[model samples]
Target chain A: MILDVDFHSGVPIYRQIVRQVQRLILSGILGEGHQMESVRDLSGRLKVNPMTISKAYSILESEGLLQRRRGIGLFVAPLAESRKASQSKALFDALLSDVAAAAVQMDVDLPQIISGLTEHYQKIHSQKEK
Target chain B: MILDVDFHSGVPIYRQIVRQVQRLILSGILGEGHQMESVRDLSGRLKVNPMTISKAYSILESEGLLQRRRGIGLFVAPLAESRKASQSKALFDALLSDVAAAAVQMDVDLPQIISGLTEHYQKIHSQKEK
Candidate 1:
C-alpha cells in the first residue's frame, strides 16, 4: 500500500501509480486477494487526481493484475505461480539491463559496481527490518 | 551522437535528451571540447521539435556540461576530473540503490542479481567492442 511518485519526474502520475502497483503485485508484496486502496482514498493520500487513480486501476484491471468485486473494491488477481515467476524475471532483467548499461556508460568498473550494489542491498535490507 | 527517446514513456522528451547527453559527457564518450550536434540537425535526426532540443541544450549549458563557443556551436565543457568522478559516483550510486531495492522487493537473491548484472555488463561490453 506504500507508493511514492515524483511529480517533477515528467512521468505521468497515472503511469507511476500503475507501475508501482504492478511492482507490488509482481513482487508478491501484495499477494492474491489483497484489496487495493479505494480510488478516493488513494487519490487523497497521493494528492493525485481521482480520475488519474481510477485510470491506473482501470489499466491494472484490464491487465488482469487486479479484479473488481461489485460493491466492494479491487483486489490482486490470482495469478499462477509460474506466470508470476516469469513476469518477475522479465521485469528484473529489464531493470538489471538498464543498470548495467548506465554503469558502463558512467565509466564505473565492475568491482566498484558490485560493491555498490552489495552496499545498497544491505542498507535496504536493514531498513526493512527496522 | 547516439540518443533515443521513448515518446510513449510518459517522461518528457527534453528530459530524455538531457539525460542521454549527460550520460555521454559523463562517460567521456563526448570528451571536453567536443562539439555538439547543431540543434536543427539533431532535431531533424530525432524527429523532435527544434525547441525541445534547444531547451535540453540550454539546460546543459547552464549546468556547465555544455558551453557556447561564440558563433561556432555548443561544446562539452572542461569539467574538472575530480568533479566528474564525484558526479559519476553519485549518479551510479543512486541507480544502484534503486536496483537493489527492486531486487529485494522482487525476492531475487543476491547471487541471481549479481549474475544478471555480470551477464548484462558482458553483453554491453561486447556490443561496444563490436
Candidate 2:
C-alpha cells in the first residue's frame, strides 16, 4: 500500500515492507484469510520493483505472515500474531546480544545492563497499560 | 568484545556491532575519548572478518556516534546522545510509515492507528516514569 515509503533510510526496503505488513497484521488491519494484493499489483501501486515487493512478501511468508493460497492470492495467514511474537523474540535477542557486547567493550558488566534493562523495561511495560 | 555474536541473525553483523557500540556510549560506559580496540583486534577476538568490524565503525562514525582521532584510535564521540536521538527518530519514522500502510491495506483510516498509537504511547510513557 501507499505508506509514502522512505527509500533513503539505513533500513532496507524489504525490511520496511516487512515491518509495514507486520504492523498491519498486529493492528488487525489485515486479518486472517484476508487477501493481499498480488506482488505485481502492489508493485504497480507502490511504484517499487516486483522483486522488492516479492522480497518483502517472501520474507514475511517465511516468517509465517503471508500464506500462499494455491491460485487465488496472498492471503493474510492465521499465524500472523505468533509470527510477530517470534519476530519480537528475534529482535530482543539481538538487543540483548548487543547490550552484552557493549558491556564487554565498555568494560562494564552484563549485570549492569540487565539491571538497567529490567528497571526500564518494567517502567515501560507498566506505562503501556495506561 | 566477546558479546557472543550470532552469525545466523537476519540482521547484518555490522549493524549488530554498531548497535553494541551505541548502547555502550548511550549508557555512559564508553565515555568521550574512550579508545576502541583496532578493527583487527576486535576481528581477531570475535573471529569475524576485519572488514566487518571496520564497516561497523565506519557506519557509526558517519552517524556521528564515533570520531576518528588522527593516529590515536577510534574515540567515543561526544555526539553519542544526539546520534541516539537521531537513530530513534529514524526508527519512529519507519514505524509510522509502516503503520500507515497497514491502515490503508486494512481499509482502516490512519486516524485509528494514530489514536491507538497516541493512547498506547501515552500509557507507556506515563508508566516509564514510574
Candidate 3:
C-alpha cells in the first residue's frame, strides 16, 4: 500500500495515485485479494483530499484492478492476476513508443540508444538491489 | 514548424507545443537560424489561442532554444548546435529514467526490457524510413 504524491507535478494527484496503484497491482507487489488501505487512511497518509483518493479508487475499480467488498474495504481484484501479462505488455508498449519517439527525434541511432538503455538499466537495477 | 496538440490530454496545450518544438529543434528538423512561423499564423494553423503559442515560444526563448530578432521574427538560437549533444543527453537520461522506473515497477527484468526496446526501436526506425 506504499504510495506517494507530488503536488508540484502538473499531473493531477488522483491520476498519479491511480497510476501508482495500477503499477503496484500489475507488478504483483500488491497481490490479488490484498486489501487496500481505506480511503480515509490513504488520504491522510498522502495528505491528499479523501475525494481525490476515492476518485482514484473508483477509476481503478472501473478498470477492474480493484474490487469493493461490502463493508470490508477495497481489495485487489482477482482478475488482476490473469490480466497481469497483457496489462504489463500494454504498459511497456506505451512506454517504448514514447522512448522511440524521443530517441528518433534526438537522432539517437539504435546502437547508441540500446547501449544507453543497458547502462541505465544496470544502474537502476543495482541501486534497487542495494 | 510542424506541431500538434491534444487538447484531451491532461498535459497543458502550451507545454505540448513547447515539447514538440523543442524536439524539432534538438533533432535538427528546425536548424539553427531557421525562422519560426509568426505567432498569429501558427496559432491560426493550430487553431489555438495566439497567447498559448506566445507563451510556448517565450518559454523556449527563455530557454535559449528560440531567439527573438527585434522585429524580424523568432529564429532558432545559434547556440542550439553546440548545446545539442548535452541537451540531447539530458533529455535521453530523463527519458531512460522514466523507462527504468516503469520497468522496475512492472517487475520487468533487464533482459526482457532490452529485448522489448530493441524490437520497438526497429519498428519505429523502419516506420520512419518508410
Go through the candidates in order and give the clash count of each: 0, 3, 0
User: Model 3's CAPRI class?
Assistant: medium
Candidate 1 is scored at a TM of 0.90
lDDT string for model 2 (B9-57, tens) is 7778888888767666665667788888898899998899999999999
Off by over 4 Å in 1: A6-10, A44-50
**Candidate 2, superposed: residue stretches over 4 Å from native:** A1-4, A59-71, A77-130, B1-4, B60-72, B77-130
Candidate 2: lDDT of A54? 92
**Interface root-mean-square deviation (Å) of every model:** 1.4, 12.3, 1.4
The predicted structure with the larger TM-score, 2 or 3, is 3
Q: Of the candidates shown, which would achieve the greatest TM-score relative to the real structure?
A: 1
lDDT of 2 by residue, A13-100 (tens): 7787887677667556677889988988888888889999899988889878789888888888886456655554444333333333
Order of candidate numbers by lDDT, starting with the best? 1, 3, 2
Instruction: Mark the 10 consecutive residues where model 2 chain A has the least summed lDDT.
Output: A92-101
Q: TM-score, B chain, candidate 1? A: 0.92
Alpha-carbon local distance difference test for all models: 0.89, 0.64, 0.85
lDDT of 1 by residue, A32-122 (tens): 9999999999999989889999999999999999999989999999999899888888988988998888877766778888999999999
Considering TM-score, where higher is better, how would the candidates rank from best to worst? 1, 3, 2
lDDT score, candidate 1, position B12: 88
In order, what is each prediction's RMSD in angstroms? 2.1, 9.4, 2.3
